[model samples]
Target: MTEEARPESPDIPAAEFEDSDLLRPIVESGVGFRVTSSLLLLVLLTGWVIFGRQLLYGLGVTGLNQPVAWGFYIVNFVFFIGISHAGTLISAILRLSQAEWRRPITRMAEVITVVVLAIGAFHPVLDLGRPDRALNIFTAGRLQSPLLWDVSSISAYFMASTVYLYIPMIPDIAILRDRGVWPHWFYTFLAWGWEGTPRQHAVLERAVSILMVLVIPIAVSVHTVISYIFAMTLQPGWHSTIFGPYFVVGAIFSGIAALMMVMIVLRRVFHLERYLKQVHFDYLSRLLLIMSLLWFYFTFSEYLTAFFGNEPSEMRVFFYKVSGPYAPFFWAMVVTNFLIPVLILSFRRTRTIPGIFIASLSVVIGMWLERLNIVVPSLANPRLPLPTGYYIPGLVEWVMFAGGIATFILGFVIFARFFPLISVWEIEEGRRLSVAETTERLEGYLPDPLPSAPGQPVSEGG
Candidate 1:
């Protein structure tokens, strides 16, 4: 029998074949992919079913109550949104700085931003109980409400992040198009007629440069606005001036952790060890450590100020966190967010891949706990003379939380099935251009050769 002949892709030069491994996941699927995708889909479906129950039964199905009106949903919303920062902000910064090691990692980072942002955005609807009530924010919303600000900022962020994610993907899409990958129309359309011409490359670079600069401020403002939701309030723990920067720091901290974990998992799953090397993890781990320290500093400053001020209302919430019912979670946040990460990430002996993974996992958990502490404690201990509130997340909330996670995983899985998780074009671009660019940049950083005693020849090394 004659073997099938593949169509020739004239646009793809021989160099495009250099990193065929990056395209392996798109072309092949094994049992692991099937099982993982199936399980994730099941969890997502279950979450939707539980959400339907909540919709029918009302917000009473959840742990929300009079004073502690925000529970798991809001906490998860903030946490997930915080995780979204792992992508666009970090990727944009790396791209802007022209970090050569960013080639294989930026795509995954940007993907995290877009996927997690979608899940996080949907959470407000879940929190509303009556999902229809969310529309009222657009129609009858007041500028005075921080909730309105959240909607505006998050919406802007979502749009910017989506565009930022897509623009960089066009060349890859065009490659897939030329290769005649399945769903030809999809790749062809999204490729936006990319032809790999010199002008096309120049245009893409300029667009990415402009977008990277623009995305930084938008990404920073997103979490800051989310912080304002709590900080603008007169409530004790929520009313701190530091909350804006605190929230941003925590978001970046959690984001870096989440990004690292995703990179590690994908590296193992796709056998991408060649692309995601030890240096990538090492650099990222250092950033995570720095953020961990910053997180601790903010946490310390916020609490120290509260401790020193000694206002009766502030003390109520402060003790409620440090010694009251929330003490366990609060302390756990310190250990996971600060101590574990710092200890594991500080020493070279413990900063291996596995250790970094553990540190990243700890930071993720700690960040969630941090969000919980921020949201529940202040509301639980109101300034008014009310009973101390307690919250145990209901089954629906737990399932929805699981579903949010499942959704994030499934989004990555599906994206991998269609597109390369590591940016193929960027990796190729780095190989083709970054070495020389970096050399030039380094030369710029060095001192110029001396005049060499009027007429003496300068050393070639100089």
Candidate 2:
């Protein structure tokens, strides 16, 4: 293709190309962006200040005590990490499947993975009270410990997912470079001299293909390793064989919901109706619905196994979640993660943007609750006959939680300010090429025209 016909070509007039909308967030700034980013920054700063207090005062400042050692930090750690799965896994799956509709959604999905993963990775440090102690996991860490497994798996995941997120962005970075977007040197460096040549496109495509395949297992294993932190223990409610798949399902379920919410908000804020249409919402909501049902299945199987076994140690922890102080959170998780999502997403009428937003929000809340229920109740009801433990997050923990959230939002805000949240080049490729590709694929699904009826007149029947 000529330079003029290249998808990333700067010679193409902005008026003619629909993808200029994707560039608006990067090139143009307005009052709302400033206000929103400022608020998020304030929250992030407050969170850091509270974290500083924790550093000075130590774990004594938090609700953690006795048996219930982990609190909001670990819970949020699991929850945020689970949310991180929303990006790379889904984007990789869609890309691997060659889903044409994935073009507009994958960029934002990948962003969620990298940012949320970073935040989630920090939670372990926060849990350590003294951040410096985390170094022990590297210097004095044991291979047998699940904690070490967590560090290794999460670190690998962060690296792989970051590279996965950056590789496909090179073309768009090159476009910004050609258009003389600000920070020219930055884009020029990241672009690596991308000129949209056939060889360059082939190399980029091959690298992306390899990363997508590799990322799926890494994403799955990240959550499975997280689950191992609990399952490898002999503690009540934690010693279970099914926790691996269960955690993975929960991760993807929560991840999809999180991704959906991000898409809806960005779609509205950026006025991207042309790119993120109703069909995108419909398709993603359906995936969310499927995940909801799967999540319920895993949840039910887990609880049912414990209930049927009637193991005394497990029953105590189980009852604590079902009827004790955590009951509210447990049932609320059921309602939000399963009932609300299923009900809202089941019907076409309720699967609209507003409805999906509500469902997605509920799932996000419910998944966090699920993490809380999983972590707290088990610890509160120890297998030993020790006194029952309790936890209520201190102000510092709450602030830190808020900070984690603010950091997530701020990451996206900062990213939007610097780069197109939507993948311009991919969207252009889909518009130019996917239709014919899809048509051919669909035609392949049909019988081969019954061998053309032995070439009897070679009928081109309507």
Candidate 3:
């Protein structure tokens, strides 16, 4: 074996470290974990209590009136779904690009996609409050409605993302199974007889590659269809050809921000400093910055087109956004979504972990407001002009919203307790194979050394 074949870089974490360290979370999370988890679960239960109240009192418990039938629930539906885009979409893109750094981050991203997606999927049903009737769409399902398209697409995405999240996790689960972790039977079942043989490894890689290619379009379509829920309508502000791309971009933008926040929290909580290094943060921050710019451009083009068109209905909604009751929310959205992120993430001096967290927090809040603005204004200031109705989400909606967020956190906590947030096998694989693979690929790019200048110098070490 050549001397160079040995893994040399000190910074390259050892595969054995996976056994010693990464498995710790699965084996034992400290007492603080229990306390915090109990708290999150308690908070999550409160939302159910509020939901029960809504059931008792009826939809009147919400602020939904004639014109503004949507409220915090629908806005949060869009917001949470947007956050869902961060996971599988980014992870798939990075993996397809053959990015080595993606190994540590992809699992978390995919998990976020899966967990938040499940949470988001229930939002529309929550809005309806009749989970039983949600199935009527299937019983009396009409292919004509855009709402039907949303149901089909989101359901497909959820199933696809869950499978994607699971496929890569099998090897790790097998490792835990072999180690005889407490839930040996569960991991044993999940591992699916994976012995990490050469054939198994190859099959795993092929499956991941195919899924990565497929997931990007599915992720994009999920948010695009969600946008169609509004865009398909002939409402004043909601109707636009750009809404599809706009929603897709906004989804990814918010998704990246949400991922950053998750990354930060997981790193701090799990003490994963070795796995999730500062370089990961820097790479992810660059993505966050790019998405921020794209979001700003979309928002600009959207409003600019409206301002120039000056249609009475569009203008009423647009002007209301700029200077009416919603003005504060609109400008705040701009500042949080664009200004704060741009200012913090643009410069390395302030792009610390905390900085990214603050920026991510801003983007999350801003994106919620952005969704609210998109949903409310056009409905409140209807083109038909039947006494503009304003929406203020009542106590029930606020409790439910808090519960939804708590559910996300609690889900992550529960997931971490059960599994390693990082893809330990993928990291080891990269350390082992990526060097040789990258060198071979780079060699293919060189022009065969120019035939040694026609043999003028056939020097041995030239």
TM-score of each: 0.95, 0.95, 0.94
Q: How many backbone clashes does candidate 1 have?
A: 0
**Native-vs-model 1 lDDT?**
0.91
lDDT against the true structure, per candidate, is: 0.91, 0.91, 0.87
- Tens-digit lDDT track of model 2 for 242-287: 9999999999999999999999998888888888999999999999
Cα lDDT over the full model 2: 0.91
Q: Write the per-residue lDDT of candidate 3 for residues 1-462, one digit (tens) a residue.
A: 333443442222334554358778777778978998999889888888888888777789898988898888899989999999999999999989878889899999999999899888889888895766888999999989988988888888898899999999998787777778777899889989987666676789899888888888888898998899999999989999899999999898899889889988888878889888899889998988998999999999999999999999999999889999999999999999999999999999999999999999999999999999999998999877578789888988888888889989988988888888998777777877799998998899886764656647666673
| Model 3 Cα RMSD, 1 decimal | 3.9
In candidate 2, stretches whose alpha carbon ends up further than 4 angstroms from where it belongs are: 1-16, 452-462
Candidate 2 vs candidate 3: which has greater TM-score?
2
Q: In candidate 3, which residue ranges exceed 4 Å CA deviation?
A: 1-19, 452-462
Model 1 worst lDDT window (10 residues) = 1-10
